[model samples]
Target: MRCQTCGDATSPEHHECQRCYTPLGQPAVTPGLPTYRVRGIGLAANVAVGATAVLYLVVALYPLIGMVMARRAMANDDPDLLVSALIISAVVALIMTVAQLTAAVLVIIWTWRARKNTDAFPGAEPAFGPGWAIAGWLVPFANFVVPARVVAGVARDSLWRRATPPLVAVWWCSWLVFSIGERLATRADDRAYEKLAETPFDDAGYQAYVDHYQDALLRNTVPALGCVIAAVTLILLIQRISAAQEARIAHATPQWPTAPIWPAQVWPAAQPASGVQSAPGAQSASGVPGVQPAAAAQPLSEVPGAAPAS
Candidate 1:
């Protein structure tokens, strides 16, 4: 094996170089800087988004439940059932609104984390988290287009910079379109309800209200589907980037050998005495007492009647 510090051949069992004596696997001389726990933040954000989205599902679907209850109330002429359903439906809508806002907040955090994590990567850009811009979706008039464009721009950045995949672009774009459609459908349903309220004494307009309610229900599904697709894409992109980075780091680092053996020079064992006298300088400097030698410590091969050492 070779010593990493001195770049010289070394025995496998030694931690220090034989020539320079420098310590070979000591920690980095300069302490490594701490990095943001980007993976953990992303995981938390994903969890929050998932939970909020589930709450949104319940809230968003409440109106349909309300519609069903309202129809039952109308057919049976039960004012109590009608009032109860209306209140429940209204509360659920309010909850859904809150969940959507919360999800938007989480998405912003996710975007910021993504940018921060990518900062140290080779060829990284100067973009901040997209969460700052996605907040525009919560705005009334601006929500119609700005949010979608912001997502598209981020997605584009991800692809061009190799920050994320092309599928992310598609997913965010679909989400933006669906979000706008859902808002419009919701407004239409609200307006229909208002119109129905104004003609409270007439039962003839109930069908129109039901139709608008169904439209909102169907329109909301688009955004839900888009969210599901986006979530899946995000998971895949994160895994790929993370794995690539890990492999690169591992490959760049040096590895040490694990064996305990050494390769020092080897010498043959001395032969036993042949009851013959040795010539001058026949024995080694740190002489073995019982060993016989050749004439003047001649090589073992030339020694007479000195069978090779067992």
Candidate 2:
């Protein structure tokens, strides 16, 4: 068999890889998971990713509308009309933002599940422990680095530790850069809106707000584009990883016809002791094997070396 860690060819009879000493035949935490069920997670994640990608595409273009509106407001085309446009834009942005966040959450959940499923096999040794997949994205400063590392590790392990997925770096870089841009732009946007609130309809006072709004809209495009690319790349990575795991599990195991074997026993039926005298020529009434009648099964009553009746 090929060693998972060291890529060494070794005799199949050995329990550990000769080159790297990695243990073989280790039991899975979730044994007997069906392929279709495991694949279902990937399918669900892909759906979320596809939805996110489409929404991100909308997000990318949605900014253009905002930029145009801001420009119109700056030109003082119509104060009431621009105010109404801003309200409408705000509502649409809120709904889409909620949707995008939901999709992102779904992606994380499914990806984490997929990584866990890979652990059902020995060859797929993900670098990060499973919790980081979720927590990596939640922790404040650590999130920026941890999530990317976790993804890279899972991507490599999913491929049988053979090669890293090509787009993983791209996905991580774009995601981080876009996130930074989004945060900065949001702060600027808030300040811009605060200024606009100070003078609801004054054209001369609106220029700063209009400029900042335009900047925010344009800035959002960075993350939106990143979201689109990351979603697509991630969908592919998930599909690849899940497929590899399915193949590995099928090849590494053949368990459908097997039965569970208990590790030890207790509460066994009582048995007759050796050398107790039984009525001459009598046998046990029950059909149990190797158990003589009580009379011939007394415990330690006979001499240790004494001959017994034939």
Candidate 3:
């Protein structure tokens, strides 16, 4: 049968269309199962994440910009310019941080909704419960693995048990790299600051501290690149899963036929066959059972004016 929504051809056994996941016919509603309405949040999530990715690109330029500014300031012996550059970089970093947090929240909400919708799909068994969609990102060590698993489950169940794309793994790996690399860079900065504090008065030690700080700033590019990659891949994944869920929801909804109903006609009863005679007390030739033929016509002897019968 062709799907009513997408016009895709599907087998009689399939309740939903393969292309759009729209229900082929009226689907049976299971008793006691709560209905989950799937909403399209992918676009919003993508916008936020795409913005975050762009900000990551800007953040990546920070280390290179910082190193150049530092060197030029040192060469020109202008301390003020160096201070100004640092302040600008700080402001940009702050903005990027806010955007990242906002994107994360939107993504979590989208995933939660998607996971919940899987319950409404026929034969869709998600690996994780809907709660994990949020909690997976909050738990410390488990966050590394759980969030990916949750996303994978949503993808698999949403696409009618299809295999998840490699993009999920790529996104997870990049996210891990960005997270770990950022932590290392932060620690390195802290150690460099501690050393500088210990030798505040030594000119040679101060020079070494400056070089260390510049090197640390340069190293930030790795994590920044990782963040960029992670954001892009995540946006794609979100779009795919959201679209699939929407299709599935469309399939589940009941659609009433639009054609008008006409009243049925009452057929008249059958008549006996013409010119066919039946013996007296016999059934009619029309083949109507238990219906005897009319009484035979009166004889001439029974007429009043006729001579008496012998």
- Tell me how candidate 2 scores on lDDT: 0.64
lDDT of 3 by residue, 146-230 (tens): 9999998887776554676688889999999998998897688667656644423344444554676577767777888888889
Over 7-115, each residue of candidate 1 has an lDDT whose tens digit, in order, gives 5777757765555343455321112422233455556556666665666577556668767865665666555665676678777768767766765666666555544
lDDT of 2 at 191: 71
| lDDT value for model 1 | 0.53
Top TM-score hit: 3
Q: Please, what is the whole-model Cα lDDT of each candidate in the order they appear?
A: 0.53, 0.64, 0.70
TM-score of each candidate?
Answer: 0.55, 0.64, 0.68
Deviating ranges (above 4 Å) for candidate 3: 1-40, 193-214, 256-310
lDDT of 2 by residue, 1-310 (tens): 5654445776768876654344663432235653333467677778867776676556546646665665676676455645666677677667667766876787677667766665655545677877888988898898988877777776776564455666888887777766777677668767767766544466655565566556766777777777777777777877877776666555546457668785552322554554454443444545334445454464443546556656
Clashing pairs in 2: 273-297, 276-295, 276-296, 276-297, 276-298, 277-295, 277-296, 278-295, 278-296
> lDDT of candidate 3 vs native?
0.70
For model 3, give the 10-residue run with minimal summed lDDT: 267-276
| Backbone clash pairs in model 1 (N, Cα, C under 3 Å; residues 3+ apart or in different chains), count | 1
* Clashing pairs in model 1, backbone N/Cα/C closer than 3 A: 108-131
Q: Report the lDDT of model 3 for residue 72.
A: 63
Error of 1 at 162 (Å): 4.4
> Model 1 off-target regions past 4 Å?
1-34, 126-164, 198-209, 235-310
